[model samples]
Target chain A: MSAVGGAAVPAVDERVTRVNPLRRAFTRPEMGAVAGAVAVWVFFAIVAGGNGFLTLRGTASYLEVAAELGILAVPVALLMIGGEFDLSIGSVIGAGSMTTALLAAQFGWNIWPALFVSLAVALALGAFNGTLVLRTGLPSFIVTLGTLFMVRGATIAITRITTGRTQVGNLDEVAGYDVARTLFASSIPVGPAALPISVVWWLALVGLGSWLLLRTRFGNWIFGVGGNTASARNVGVPVGTVKVILFMLTAAAAWLVATIQAVNFGGADVLRGSDREFFAIIAAVIGGNLLTGGYGSVVGAAFGALIVGMIQQGVVYAGIDADWVQFFLGAMLLIAVLVNRAIRSRAMGGRG
Target chain B: MSATVSSRVAAPAPPELAGTTPLLEVRDVSKSFGSVIALKDISMSVHAGEVMCLLGDNGAGKSTLIKILSGVHPASEGEYLVEGKPVRFGSPRDALDHGIATVYQDLAMIPLMSIARNFFLGSEPTRGVGPFRRFDLETADRTTRDEMAKMGILLRDTDQPVGTLSGGERQCVAIARAVYFGAKVLILDEPTAALGVKEAGVVLRYIAQARARGLGVIFITHNVHHAYPIGDRFTLLNRGRSYGTFAKDDVTREEVVTMMAGGEELEELGHELEEFARADGLAAGRLGEVGRELEAEARG
Candidate 1:
């Protein structure tokens, strides 16, 4: 096929295939997600405007939830683009927060040391997942699925054994809790609404992740390893290293998310972050990231998270059943993947 | 076919390349995996600005020979030379660092990535200093376009995914990448074997383009038609042993095919198949038809 804009340009090199600037925009992984996000926003605004879905406070309410999931979805998208998955992120949230809550509340330790040690525990869990996947050569899907159960089981057993309860409290009364809250759970006033600090963290991660994926040498390696592991290895790309790093990053993001949730709730429950792993994946998939790996964008995942937030908040605003949020989410994921397939094909065909 | 093929092995270089050192040379190379011999006493040379076509069918030790030359495996017994100095490569990267690049059949390209990105996959070029440094997109794009142009392809943009390009174009991109990275000897593994006739023709033209650019090319394939047109020399292999190297002018297309298929063995198989065709009718008729083609090729 001839290039999309081949006819518009005067002949200089007759054989040269012209690249249309507009078509190039369609090639970005986030393009479809951005379009879908805007459409979702418009739909909600039209249907639920009288219910205050269009108000500044309503925006803040949804963004607060979006930012929380965005933090996890961003890294998950990166990992998926690198051709792997971390199904244990939901467990990581539980484990990380449980460690912090256990040290601070049950053991009467200060919150600062509790959080620091929890960070270490979280990072260690990440490294463990990465090492296990790499060493065993098992699909990250199955390996992380195992970790999802193991880590969840460990959190439950350890919490029950230590305190005779499946949850921990009194973390808000622990020393150093104020300072830790100021850093993680604090909010910023924006016009008529107060924006949660999680939004800040989410935005920072998007900027950092984007720069990493599009600009850095390692970012280039991530795309290469994800796109074609065998081909990338043949050309001397360190395929294992890229994937392992992605796994670790996904775990770290989960830990960050867990800390925010724990601080916001003033305690950690063994059941906290349940089904979050699936939600994070749903966000990535809805953002137009391919499940097969190699072709995706972190920004798209953030928008996926945005769509999720809208559905969760919009159903209540529109006076629909809250339970239908799950149904809406599943439907969005299916539509997104179908939309993404068409966009990806058009991009590759240079017919965009 | 029964001969060991040692008697016919050329002595490293031809008369035309006698004084000057060839870009890549293998002398009496033999390889064995435990008790099984993969290659036996093979010798060949590739000079700059020439296409050395390595022709063979299945189980002809082509991949083994490629592995040796590309440094995936060390030679069990032989000397591999570059510019008259013998060397050993521990890995493919070592061979690449020494200016020997292999464009394998799959071509080592990521389909979803931009052409420029795939062109600089493992060894990305970056500008700036420290943590803020990033991939030099301008240079990568410009260089990809220029290198492709050198291979006789003109592109308006280098950001198009490699999957969008035709198979032959992808081959050219791989070749251009190897050339851009300073490859002196290019070992192309069945570049045109997966292409349509027109696409194969396109790749053959690129091979000629590579030769004109002064690179020593080692093109491996079973298809003689694809090889015979652009090759300077043909080195035939049969059942892991070299049948000997023949200059393009010294052998006709038929003779090259015959030697590659083991001429005497082919004639015997053809007669046997013809006899089986008399006993078994329909299915064996297909076999007899192949036998007739083999008999004709064997006679040439």
Candidate 2:
């Protein structure tokens, strides 16, 4: 429809027909993730029927597991789309939980102050990861990987050195413990099911993350920097600052999850959230996020966490071996990426 | 502003154009990287509502000169003037603050983003305040479509990703975006170099459109045919130095091509190559094949 070739150009109005709303929706990057979630849910419902896996109580169990991972997965998805990775989030959780435990139990501090210290430690870990990556121009994958082991070691060593055991206990006896538990660990009752408070937190975080990703200038800059860093610089985007802020957001989510778990259990296991970093990344990949970055959705990552949660609990309910969950998740990641690429290609007129 | 542009070839430079100062003027500008001098003693001026074509052979420091003008690199020596006043640019943003915009060959656009999004990449239109501020998609789409139409680029869907557009269309979008953003002096880096015949024609028409809109345009190209039609003034660069600047009324298209191709030196090299081929038995047949291909290209 260029004026240079106006001879056979179709009428402008004819070319301007409204695109089908449903087709447009289907073309979104998250569609594959959504469809996969539905498929897995249906499959689990059929396989685990009469075994209580589809029951309200069973649903709450899976949702609780999903909520813990979803809180981390949403920000992880954002980080991935911004072209970086934070492998230290799992260790940040352990670090946060241990900080809360040591400060409250060993140091005789109030639980509220202890929680603040834990949050501060988590933020520091995130800032360290972000600054190192930006300043040294090293890959975040390598930088956060180093911090991952360092934080894990520090959490274990500090806990064992102060407390008699690797685990810190007796958190419930601390002052203001009841308020902390009420805010983070308490569950809400509905009919025959008890929904964990983390689920509500997860939903809130998802809403906020989605809003930040889709509705703001920062979101546009995230996509721009991730897609083409040189071009983003040419256009005057503060790429490093956007990346640092995203890293902090991921760390904050980790602290939230750790707070929820430590309060609910009234203790800290030095090895808490072990290997969950890989799980969070898997969830992001399954949510249709590219490992190479520049494309993804917060909603898709949430669905990916749901899939993981279902498979994690559904395997036990169906009497299947628990070890198969890892294999299924690994396979799901590959399948979702392929499915997303195919849909993207078709929607983008075969540019995939 | 529109008074300076006329559809006829070799139209006299407008009275206001001659009366007012040039928007951008460079005097004896030179750039060097380490021991190598990329550009030397290059001087040029671009007036508003004028298309100044920069003609050069490969490795003739055309890119270096454009970079200096667009603020990607500072001139190693000499003065850069804007609006009859001297100015030093620290970055592209500094130049942009003075209403100077550069459309690089890469376009600095994200292909995965929509046209409206890329149109307003760093300077997005937003409403609300603080955390509540949001990208104004409605206004963006409307402005993008409206501005492109003004440049005679009628994209049916402004929401479409820029990757799906043809090369010519993308150039037009870049031009339209620059104009809409209040660019007084626009620099395009080899806009037609990678395009097809029809596509290049489309880009040329938009350059004319930008000229008609009264923006001072610096169109960088090595192709004389592309430069001659719309160029009011031509500055030929060879071996890191300016050969001369010529108005359209002063130079012929063939003369520009001959000078750009290094004139008699190129003919001497061709003759030497032909002689070398004839002097060797094995090279004669291979050179004949190359000669045939070159002849075919010329015929096409």
Candidate 3:
């Protein structure tokens, strides 16, 4: 209602109303992550003994593995936040690696060209997945699942047909191996500890993803699409386009991760990158991303990857069976998801 | 009475013959889905600086006409004119490109995104060169705040997600966006349907503000109460056919309500109520009370 007698309008008055401090705290994701991070450190330190787990070398090892997984998780988290998924990313990694090896080993292509071809192939595959999901109006999960199997089958068939083996090698001959290794595989030593280049890539990607999600239009579209697609459409957003781009971005990250693995190991396995979709999804969920869409953080996702990476190395450091990693990861995924849901429900004033 | 007189005296010259033509004109448009005819020869015109309310009951083809105008579906037959030139839109984008924007009841905003980001989702301003074209955050925040302020929404912060805003604030933001983007014709679909009385008034004021800025506004609603005061012209629809389109001076609120409920339905309902009252042995003088109840039921 309009105000009378020069009285301030109630709507205007409400705008100036002081927000409840509790409500303000509940609205932010950063506060929750900081608390989670502290809890994680405390838990790991207690389990591994103060000196063993908190050592620089132990931290570097965790950072190394987390960085590699974190790079993929960032884009995967973003895609999830945008209300979509890219199950085919695991296959894209194998596809990228195989392409790189095929170009360099079989065709005598330079490393730069091989890597370029690999990335281009990955982008094309991503575009295909995006287009199919958009055109068919199918769920991204189903569409990318189809692409996942199709690309995996294609990768295995091609690798066996060309090399008469289940694996591709001789990528070392590529002209850009030295540069690739330096960027993706090389390590930086600080005093007695060394940090892998992949860790740096992971950190940079996390930073970029965080900025894009919080401060950019693309980030807004992600939240919009995830929150309510119908509502997003009413507001003039190109919902289909945003979804397609997110799928492509996730695939691109997969390509980057595969490149690092290929260079680091000096070969590609037909079964390489298996179950990475689950890992990336779990990491994202653990990091505070809602599986139903609309809310998430890149830092949270990276931290999720850190948790997984730490558990992986922590098992060996504690002299426990390495095979138990999968069991722990599975349990952690469920617990993290439950925790995330609980936190989200609480944040939304317990409506759920 | 004095307010009505003031409004009349304050009315500017028609301005219909000025440089700008009516932004959107629907000339006897009709549509049918399979066996059901949704809209039958509905003719309406929207000029800049005026509010044209499309009033109808359920099944009156209000949704059908809006779908046609907003490019959700094409009219089965009849002409849609833009700038006095005939045209047909294949999709929502086509309508948008023609400077027509549709704000549906749901508002189409992403609740998880900040207000500034939702305001410029698709057409974000960018800084930097190729391969590094970053979003222009400062511009988006400043413009979103300024535009909302102009529309009488003084947001506490542009950084808050749209979901945090009240229903009325969201509608205002959508309208401000459409206006800011240079929409000549603005079609609002049941914007106040889900809002409370106060929130509905907030949206209505913004609608008036939009009209004042010289944008043709098509305000669709089922509530005659909401339509009567703000609407300059009213078009009534019933079962896919136009009852009539009248200027504000030509019809009263009661007539519009009566028209929406077809004459036959009203008569039938009245007869049923009288018979029931007689059968129940109500006093003769209580007939007026019975008649009023029948009228209310018929209107509803």
Q: Which candidate is the best by lDDT?
A: 1
The runs of at least 3 residues in candidate 2 whose Cα sits more than 4 Å from the true structure, single-residue gaps closed, are: A1-20, A161-165, B1-19, B276-300
How do all models score by TM-score?
0.91, 0.89, 0.87
Better of 1 and 3 by TM-score: 1
For model 1, state the Cα shift of residue A333 in Å: 0.5
Which is the leading candidate under TM-score? 1
Q: For model 3, state the Cα shift of residue A306 in Å.
A: 1.7
Model 3 residue runs over 4 Å out of place are A1-26, A173-176, A342-352, B1-20, B32-36, B273-292, B296-300
DockQ ranking from best candidate downward: 1, 2, 3
**Candidates ranked by TM-score:** 1, 2, 3
| Comparison by TM-score, 2 against 3, better one | 2
Cα lDDT tens digits, model 2, B1-300, are 112112223323444567688899899998999999999898888999899999998999998998899887899999999999999998777888788888887855677777887888878889998879998877887788778777777766776778878778888888888888899999988999889989999999988988888899999999888899989988888889987777887767876776676655555555555566778867486774565544333322
**In order, what lDDT does every prediction score?**
0.87, 0.84, 0.80
Kept native contacts, as fractions per model, are: 0.57, 0.41, 0.37
Better of 2 and 3 by DockQ: 2
Q: For candidate 1, give the DockQ.
A: 0.48
CA lDDT, candidate 2, residue A278: 93
Chain B: TM-scores of all predictions: 0.89, 0.86, 0.86
